[model samples]
Target: MPNTNGILGRKLGMTRVYNEFGQASPVTVIEAGPCVVLQKKTVGKEGYNAVQVGFREKKPSRLNKPEVGHFKKSGGTGYYHVREFKVEDPKIYELGQQVNVTEVIKIGDKVDVTGRAKGRGFQGVIKRHGFSGGRATHGSDFQRQPGSIGSSAYPSRVIKGKKMPGHMGTDKQTVKNLIVIDIRVEENILLVKGAVPGAKNGLVSIYIKKA
Candidate 1:
């Protein structure tokens, strides 16, 4: 059966590890937390049910007074990262309870991950929106340009939400239904099939996928 709980893990760089047949496999080493339960949301109180999980504790001096009060109410140190996850059952959760990778994960399960995509600053239409550029042989003046951005005198204005060149990436993205191939309880690690989103050490949120 698939585990209902989700884990918050950090990408601990990538490496190649051998499988059972002794074949090399590309693996992303993840450091899944011992996340603390910051707050327990209930149906009546928050109008929904969820658990607020916190990871990567910050130093007391690094936190402000308001944050200090929040963590103190839950009897925890300064937690740098905090996220609210929806859970159907609040019976299994409690305030200040610690969560780790091992509790919620098994060897094989489907999960979805959300993260920030890599930033490719100021890309062209050819690269950003996949528009075909001008011919390389001829005088390709419009080579990388977005080309006539507006309707010629008919509209006489740049259309709203045009797919022109500008900023690209560093956007929030969700990668769905990734299979968890392996789990290391001792190291608090998970080996998922295929690549996860974002650069190394980027914050990624793992959740149970809908069947």
Candidate 2:
């Protein structure tokens, strides 16, 4: 409704949906929108057109003084998540205006879902990079170890950007071109075909595909 093409939402897990042909398709459930416009930026003033919105209202007591002051203009309401989305014209959206999921996207639309992937916490190369481990028979000791990281005489150091055993996941990831299977405007629920990144109840940003 604000000339924006994206919305902030929460991942509500995955479920299967049946089509008219009786085919079951896996879909990720997302609780999208009802986002409030916190601020508006115009091209004349901010050198760009964008609308800043907030989702998941939070208690006023939980927010700091600066945060409370920032939300003062927007009906004195606090939110847990705040994100800025580019808009064609920011003047059309008023401050504190609530945006619903139906306004930005609809069923059969293609969207890009962005979220933080689940953290695996210090994973090895086998699980992290999908490296095939060494032979498991005949007293082979190099089962899961990352064999031969670097040359001893040539580079003399471990190569940068090399896939090695380290921290895995918990990074921002975007799953592009996911089809919107269904939408329940009353419930603010969106069913998207295929799996998306992140764990259940995680925060995600859904942007309609421009092309």
Per-model TM values vs. the true structure: 0.90, 0.96
lDDT of 1 by residue, 56-127 (tens): 889999999889888986785878788888888765776778887777766677888887889999888999
User: CA lDDT of each candidate?
Assistant: 0.79, 0.94
Best-fitting candidate, measured by lDDT?
Answer: 2
153-174 in candidate 2: lDDT tens per residue?
A: 9889988999998999999999
Pairing residues by index, what is the TM-score of model 1? 0.90
Q: After best superposition, candidate 1 residue 200: deviation in angstroms?
A: 1.0
Candidate 2 residues lying further than 4 Å off, grouped into runs, are: none
